[model samples]
Target chain A: MAGRTARSERAAGTGEVLLAVAERLFAEHGVFAVSNRQISEAAGQGNNAAVGYHFGTKTDLLRAIVRRHAERIEALREEMLERTGDSASVRDWVAVLVRPGTQHLAELGSPTWYARFGAQLMTDPVLRELMVDETFGPTIRRTLEGLNRCLPELPLPVRLERADMARNLMVHMLAERERALAEGAHTARTSWHAYATGLIDALTGLWLAPVTTDG
Target chain B: MAGRTARSERAAGTGEVLLAVAERLFAEHGVFAVSNRQISEAAGQGNNAAVGYHFGTKTDLLRAIVRRHAERIEALREEMLERTGDSASVRDWVAVLVRPGTQHLAELGSPTWYARFGAQLMTDPVLRELMVDETFGPTIRRTLEGLNRCLPELPLPVRLERADMARNLMVHMLAERERALAEGAHTARTSWHAYATGLIDALTGLWLAPVTTDG
Candidate 1:
């Protein structure tokens, strides 16, 4: 029994290492550029098929990496939503939307790769649906509901469009800042918290922008 | 002399075909997923080294593709800037920033690949610099200058941050719409013109959003 438990623990450790290596490689190089064999090799596995053994497929591996970060991010969002319960302020709900990812990145410290990985996933045609399905949940839907309640009169199409624009802005901007910091380049905001504030402000305004009738 | 002229014309024709094929493949598959040999074969070149022989390297081929579209986009921007001379209204300057790309896309008709290609380029770390250096030109600088002049009160950092946010919004939003159209998915706006109007409204608000000092 003890031997079996140790073997399972070893397997779990190998899975964790593969996830980390895959995230960093996918972040630095394009996702399609890196192979599962490459990831297994980089993770120091004796077998070249370690990634395949631990994870069923490349998509499954990618999904695992996303799930690792997303679980924590969603928890943060849930806490923020609880605190922001029944608030009428768009900025408050916007904070609920933007702060979780930035705050999670902040807690993870510098040289993080999840943001960059997410940017690539969202940009890739086939991979984007996986990202959407994994990331958006009831918490996000509730955040949108709270935000929409704050603005009762916005056209449904406009709301949907702004939601997409806001998501793009948040994901890519976070990735941009993460890439800059990793490369030792200049960043506009001093910290992730301040960056979240900037995003929340701009996205708040984006949601409130008046819709034009004529093209 | 006549044979040499005919050879050069055929070379130019192959280059155009290579560019078109590369863009579409990169859009459909991830950029790094598609190889130069694949691009050459797809373009029906007799030799597999055709991409290397014609464009020198993948980066050079990418730049060539960007240049092909950017020249037309820049010309459109020039015409818009000429008509929008010295505009103080933020929306007018925003229109200058947004219209050129949308107008160019409209001219390309359905199933356009440039927006998706541009989105991938902007998201990739090594390739983003190429996209920015190719796309942001004298006209963009002049538009920003006019925009800054019209809003003299915004802090420089806030202005820069908002500019990045607006850019992320426009690039990814356009890519999203183009992807939807390519996949026969539903789109929020009816036409490229209306899409531009929607973007212009949101980006204008993004620029005009009030900055928060306390973070």
Candidate 2:
């Protein structure tokens, strides 16, 4: 039992290293540009098939990377949701929607790769669905429901369009900031907290914007 | 002289075919995943090196594709700017920023790939700079200047941040709509004109949103 426990722990350590390496590489390079063999090699594994052995396939590995981040984001969202508790303000719900990811990036400190990695997944034709399924859970739905309650007059189609706009803005803007920081470039906002605040303000306006034209 | 003209015309036709093929492939598959040889083959060029012969490098090919579209978008923006002409209303400037791309896409009809192709470029780490340089020409800058004129009270950092937000929203939102249309899926807005109107409304709000926090 002792030997088995040690082996399992070692395997877990290797898995963690691989995940970290894969996420950074994916963030730096395009997700589809990097291969499983390259990931295993980068992780210091002698066997090129180590990623396959550990994570099954490329899509599965991509899903694992997303799941790791999504789990933390979901936890953060859950905590924020509890604090929010049926808030009537669109900004409050927008905060609930936006803060978790930014806060998680903050907790991860500078040069974080998850934002860039998530953007890569979101941009990919096949992997977007996986990222969405992993990241957007019950907490997200609850936040959106809260947001919708505040905007009863907004039409459903416009609501949906703005929702897509909000999601795209959130994902890609975070990625842009991450990319800038990673490259030692300047960003307009100094901190993720401030950045999220700006986003919430903008998104609140976006959700509450008058529907000027019919679909 | 007549033979030379015929040769140049045929070459131009081949270039157009290659651009169309490359854009669609890059949209369907990730940009880095598709090769020049594959593009040449798809374009019915006997020489696998035709992409290199016609366009110097993969980056150059990508630029050529962007340039082709940017020319049209620039013309559209120029016309819109002539009409907008120092307008103080944020919505008018927002429409100036949003309409050219959407109007161009509208002209392209169904199964459009430029939005998807451009989104892929924007998501890419290396290629994003190329796309930005190729597309964000003088007209875009003028439109933004006009927008800034409208929001004289907004802080520079918040304005810059919201500018980034608007861009991300525009690029990825159009891509999402194009993707849905390509997949024969339902989109909130049936036409690109309506979609642009919806986007303009949301972006007008985003730009005009109050700055509640310091960056």
lDDT of 1 at B41: 91
The residue-by-residue lDDT of candidate 2 on A47-123, one tens digit each, is 99999998998888888988888889999999988888654588889998899999999998988999888987888
Clashes of each: 0, 0
lDDT of 1 by residue, B83-155 (tens): 8866459999999899999999999998799999999999987899999999989998899888999889999
DockQ each: 0.71, 0.70
Poorly placed runs, candidate 2 (over 4 Å) = A1-12, B1-12
> What is the Å distance of residue B94 in model 2 from its true position?
0.4
Under CAPRI classification, how is model 2 graded? medium
Per-residue C-alpha lDDT of model 2 across residues B1-215, encoded as one tens digit per residue: 97796576477798887888999999998798899999999877899999999898999999999999999999999998888766449999999999999999999888899998999889988789999999989999999999999889998888888888888898998899999999999876888998899998999888888878653
Lowest lDDT 10-mer window, candidate 1 chain B?
A: B2-11
Residue clash pairs of candidate 1: none
Candidate 1 lDDT over residue span A113-212, tens digit each: 9999999999998999999999998889999999999989999998999999989999999998999899998887889999999998899888888888
